[model samples]
Target: MSSYPPSVPPQSSAQQASQPTGLRQRLADLRGPAVPPRPLDARALAALAANPGCGRRALLDGAGVDKTVLAEALGSPAPFGQSQFAIVRGNSFEAKVKSDGGAELLRLVHAHLDPGGEAPGPDARVPDLSAAGPEGRAARTALALREATAAGAWTLLDHPMLALEVAGTPAYLEPDAVVVHPDGRWTVVEIKSFPMIDGAADAAKVGAAARQAAVYVLALERTAGKLPGARAGHTVLLVCPKDFSNLPTASPVDVRRERAVTRRQLERLTRVEELAAALPAGLGFGPERTAEERAAAVAAVEAAYAPECLAACELAFHCREKARAADEVTALGRSVRGELGALTTVEGALAAAAGPGAAEDPTAAALYRAALLRAEALEPVG
Candidate 1:
């Protein structure tokens, strides 16, 4: 999905100085004359960690280029669309969970994570996080958090805005909810519409929710770090519909591992400044630019294409086509790429396994043996 950067107030000098001179303008120029940097959500940002070597995703995302648009323009549109049923179901479930000043939400938090703790009273504060832009709302949320912590009350921040600096750009994030405990501890609440069948949810969905919540935990930790004695809980509340009904059941999902993975993945990202420096003299991805020009500009940067990228990245189709044309071994998978060593292409890998040097190379030797075993097995069947 394409989004323009929110109209945020001016940044402080410290924020400005975080970037080198001309970096922002250069990134803007790369995106095109009029395109706004597409705000990267936690989900998109987290996917980057999974594909660490994809320089194209990093640079395009850093520059805020709209990959959905870019992919369509390149004649390989991304097959991504949410069913209206899901959109409505998610919204309805979340609203039900947070209804009545988040009374139900507090109950679930108390029931799942802190069963021994006192339940929040009717007067539990649900902070109005409304503001002019993402930055303003994020600041407003931070202030509310501090006040709630100081007051030592149960506070629910509904849809709090957060900003995480990624690749020299601020990626704005909004979590489902952030709950402040009376004891100054904070918990992130992820409300999902997916039903927990027989008290068990889908593992993949749970994992995705955890990874997404990990990003919120990271953002919340930043806020907690500034306050004395205030700590963000490593365990997040994953609230889902129970047994296909609207009733919300909660589980305490430990996101410590996901958090560490995300943190490392984000850190491993190639800096936008370094990427911009490596670019050719003039390259632009503006909507007005010709399809060929835009494709060439995108091609100038390398992409680490994998089968999994098809699920997460808009440019997967285009990249997969390119990988196929080049016979890149990575198109099969990273595991295959690792086994091939210096043989980056399928033809090269086959050649290596058949060559005399196969005996000297461990990977080639293994492939050579595996090929023989497969051939023998198939011959008997024939």
Candidate 2:
């Protein structure tokens, strides 16, 4: 399978302008341009920034930015500064965590693949008994172990200790179960009530879960980073249900997959560490009036919530409170290069409107082409 996951491309402004034939279409999407984002309370901001992606949730939840201001900031066309850039970067890396088919397959292999495990027995019907909470998790663990022992191909680990922590962050692990295989290796199991989806539980949703498992793997490694007495390899297994109903069937996650995904994404984590190094930890974007010069940096954003700023904000109800006072219709504001800016600016709030793939808009996704045409008209780069 291809190692890289799929991604969506960004849209351009110029291509959007040509789409709308009517004036009203442009009036609807006026939030393309606005003042720079304000200073933020990083913690409050993640809630606003939260998406379905798990990694985005974990990392942003760690940083403490203000959601309202960040929401306002994202609506603007300006490129993000280093701090904002770092936060957005975190969202990308974290988006990769989640559980998938591989995890589900592992669970089946663990139970049925054993040497002489009993016939599905009394619990043959349950698709995932592991998600049954303490009683279920414990019972499932015991039954699975007995089957493993009979099969001879499997072995159950006892109270194996596991922990997942990065160099500077706290370990937020509460491993529900751990098992050792006949291969002398071990597996950690995380049971979930939700049905399994592709990459839904892997680093895609619980990206940190892999890192968390890595920490446990590290802990198992005991400083040398290797598990002693046990086999040379151990994996973190994520156990989840196979379907939405009360099916006893469950799935198992492979640790190696977690390791592979985390290694790539961990590179994206440095910005968080770098920014944390540069600024005081408890920085707040709003209410910085106590310091004279500091307040100037965010004055425009701090003074009022510009109508454009709140266009896509989840806090629309909050923004609507201020909509009555100002011209919310012009959220995109004047273009930066004026004409050049206009070409690349958000077209929704203009005389014409364009959305991503809005081939009907004033421009197709061809704002860059328009910009290029203009740039080409300018004197050579010499």
Candidate 3:
């Protein structure tokens, strides 16, 4: 049900021969009958950066299958829901920041990123980027960015939608704002409702903001690469409330390290074209179909489940349910998986610790020794 343009660029004979003939058809089929693909946003892509080994997330995301619906059908819904209060507060804060044709936003960027550079005048270009859909808007934004960079003037793109290709699929991202400096460099801006008390915000929240901005930086760089002399700056500007008040405060967060990590993780994702080849025939992962069929189709793919997924992945609850039912050691955590070595199941670990094989493997022997020590300590003093 995605509004994807049907036509792809013509492929050469060698390229045609290299790929499976019906790769796109296979992907379309995977979405089930007439199911629209869920577009991956910057936040979702950032979550992927946190856990690269999650094949289930990669396949589900690449195929554009709605994981929230799938998770509910599996009877283990993801524990994620935004409160009305937070949503209203965030929207209000963002609107206030960009109220004056982004005059306030430009001021923040100038002060934080380039106070020494040219200051943006009242005539700074803030082009209207709204379009029919995400794809159209992204294309419009890219055009505006290129033109702005070429002119080498102070420009601000407010809520500009960007598209980044991940594992052969296009993921759309919309940053709060992006500033094009007079020197033909672009900077990502993140606006948050969290209070920056005493000129400092929570470290965890700041880290999350940096990761999200880094995704935008990556997308911008891809667009800028096509135009000569245009570059996307690695440092991002974060705007937040100051001391529980409505006033805004800005800080430049350097995301070079986060950008490198995200780039590596994105590259490591399994290619969708290759994953499609391995799927079973007539598989349907759509919510419109029967739950049993959807479950079976999803089960066909292997998943690397870990407790950390609970906080990030929408399918975490569903995967956790399956892993717990199977007593998978990875359901505990990644550290537990390493400690168990080849024993991937809880029963297997317990059996090995109690059996003769405990003495063979160092990991098993260590677990057995720790268990005995605990048992001895729990015994009554006699």
Candidate 4:
């Protein structure tokens, strides 16, 4: 999707004037007066959906605070980044796939997504989406989408920007490419460097890609909703390398399930204004703030920590440390946490299992039985 230096849609003067100054100032204060807010991408949004209960993450993201930097300040820097070599390879492959005025890309789209429809010809449109800023580019992309839908032609939007409101803030997203079919259907095209061997790729990678693409589809739907007779397709084109070669191959991945799940999770998020309003006064996440201050600020808000947060959240390491210190059972894993009903802490679960109450509580009885079995298995096996 879109790279850093986030391209949020600019609010009209009247719209800006109408906003409550108190909430906006609070968010700005949390982000720091001088620091710019990092723009949220599809990947970040998907991660947010994966762990929707983390109010800490929700507020940080909504305010556009740079979590990578914030994580570093907390001494638990996020362990994710692309290597320079991988970056070069991805860029090269993407350029090759979109070459020849995206002729190959369009051909693949037609063959895979709409084979029964008319094939894309040389006359297919690749409209100019260039504009002065992110807001302009987003508006221009929307206009192009509308025109393409009205004209009923095959079109390709390269790196077009889109905006989705999350937690009362607009998050700008950019898909690798969005293909407009001849029948006015919009399909998101994701280009990745991973190899597809024997018509299959890594399942985990594909799942992650699907979740990210689902975000793009959701944003596309918002844009298409205002246009008559326009609809965003549920299936997306996942373009990747063929085996070890740079030759491009594509698969149609259905994202209806992911879309539904993400939509529900997004809806469940607590609004940013609400989260900010709940924070104590003078709580700032600016780089100049001391580590103790930052830690205290973060701890003031409750975080639902789980192992999955390691992959999806920047502050996961810090949260994990806090959870372990407090003996919170949620740090074990979501499944484990779910299975230990009413036992929020490890000590509490252990006490329940070893105490007289074990027989009265089903969960405690099960844990007690498991503990006995474990002790028996470890009994100095001769």
Candidate 5:
């Protein structure tokens, strides 16, 4: 996730009411005093959306706590780090695509997304969005978007900062680019280094990129809603490398489904203040705190762990350790946890497969039959 300087904007009456008094201070206390809160980006928000039920992640993230640092302090540091080569390659490719005032990038957008509209010409505008801070940059981006929409000309706002209110707090997001069509429609542009082979890319990487782009689309809608005759397009431009080459390729990814799912999940997330208020008093994850203290503080909240979390969450290793120590069925996987039904522990599942009352439950009966088959197979081999 990207980091930017933190800014606190004035809250409206509705926002103030939604966030209780002293909640921000309390969250600050939960994080170390004098430590800057980590600003969340689209990637973190997408991960949070993927596991909305995990209040631990929601609270930790909303509090602006640095889970990577906290994980290191707890001795279970997250194994999530991008290779330097990948980062350099991504930057180089993005620079190449956006070179010459985004001539190539605009061409791709015109070709793939808006073929019927006017083609981008040399006069296509690339707005400068520089400002004092993230808040200022966000305002600048909004102004540029509004002006671009009204002009009815092809324009690109490169790396524009957009502000999204997540659980009553503002999160600033920066997309690769935003294109304004001649018809006053805005489309998100995501530039990635992954290769699209034979008109296809890795489905997992594509899905991840689409989810991240969906977040940009959602934020764009919030800004476009206030502009007359302006709308954010559900289909976003996904630009990637073409099959083992550095040359950029474009594909249109429709993120309506992803947008809906992310929006619903974000709405379902418990407010950060409320989650903090429910915690016990005097809980802190500061560096001054001992390892045991930090562990206990983290354990105060519940976590829904699955194998998939290993990829998305910084605290997956710690949560997995806890789940395995308790023999929780969720440690196996989400599908296995669901399939086991009422058997919520590995011990319980084993007992159901070998002990009494197996006939009373469908899952248990199936497990019992499978266990008998395994025993027969082993005995015959012996």
Candidate 6:
């Protein structure tokens, strides 16, 4: 804040900047669907940066950007954009606990468990460090300095916010632990006192860490703007204790990974927009549709494919709900899809309805086929 981004000034420049270039780029994006994307926060940016492969899917989910639209944006080779996600599942939580904060003493535990949220130890051990306090300010500056020396990351002691806007917002990122891997690229590292669990970073509690790091990346990129010396990569450093009371240790995770994931997500979500665009006059995703219309849509998805739900997927709940509510067999998770009896796709229904002796099945498939046939037959021959 002291250097780059200038801290969104609580005063004058706010008017000149007109919503800070950083926020503008993030806020101005109007690509995908009828759905307005949620404003980009540090959380959203961090997510995209973390994903580089399949993590691209989360970008759409995290940003609330439609998936089909995102898929289109990505077009061919992945990672045009991205999102954040939890990488490991199996006991990463316990592993994190074992590796963080040595202060795992029961007293510390009781302090958290205790009705009154008081620190178990005297206040001296855990100081109230803030930029305003002499000790806090000194510690913060020192930590910032230490972070740069150790990481080889691009450190802006106090960068200025003069970069052009992307998506309309100024790119003012403040990087402390910008690790330029052997690849000679720039990575922004954040030192956190939190513990790491290979869990969803986008979840409410952990999302903040990623988001904060992302904002710094944005600010730094904006301020540094394509300098020949500028490194093209990005990341976040999450520092946590190996034991409850132990001093924290840090790990650098790629922000690019998250971004890659998010981009794919956006691409897929855009399909809803496509559907809306091609839909007949009044058709929509709204509940106003009659049961038949809803059933028809559901059947359409079910006919073509079944998707397997996975433990690592961020949208398990969403998939489950849609699968349950609409009988979208395709929405079922792959692991259990076969067991659950959902292997068929929408095409199967139509095929069955048009087969040599097509009247046996009375399901939605036959009805839909009949509707199409009736509509087509109704057209007078030219």
Residue-level lDDT tens digits of model 6 in 187-280: 4544333444542232443445554555555545543353444444465545444345433344545555444444443333322223223324
**Which residue segments of model 1 deviate by more than 4 Å?**
1-21, 376-382
Candidate 3, residue 301: Cα displacement in angstroms equals: 1.3
List the candidate numbers ranked by TM-score, top first.
4, 1, 5, 3, 2, 6
User: Per-residue lDDT tens digits of candidate 4, residues 143-195?
Assistant: 99999999999999988988788878777788899999989899999999989
Look at candidate 6 and tell me the lDDT of residue 202: 29
Those runs of model 5 whose alpha carbons end farther than 4 Å from true positions after fitting are 1-21, 358-366, 369-382
Candidate 3 lDDT by residue in tens digits, 220-339:
989998989899999999899999899999888999999999999999988877676677887778766788988898788888888878877888888888999999999899998987
Taking every candidate in turn, the Cα RMSD to the unseen true structure, in Å, is 3.2, 18.6, 5.2, 2.6, 3.4, 16.2
Report the lDDT tens digits of candidate 1 across residue range 117-138.
7688999998788986676788
Judge candidate 4 at residue 166 and give its lDDT. 83
User: With candidate 3 superimposed using the best TM-score fit, by how many Å does residue 329's alpha carbon deviate from the native?
Assistant: 1.2
Itemize residue pairs with steric clashes in candidate 1.
none
In TM-score terms, candidate 3 sits at: 0.88
Clash list (residue pairs), candidate 3: none
TM-score to true structure, per model: 0.92, 0.36, 0.88, 0.93, 0.91, 0.35
Q: Give the better candidate number (3 or 4) by lDDT.
A: 4
| Candidate 6 RMSD to the correct structure | 16.2
- Candidate 1 vs 3: which has more TM-score: 1
lDDT agreement of model 3 with the native: 0.81
Residue 318 in model 5: shift from native, Å? Answer: 1.1
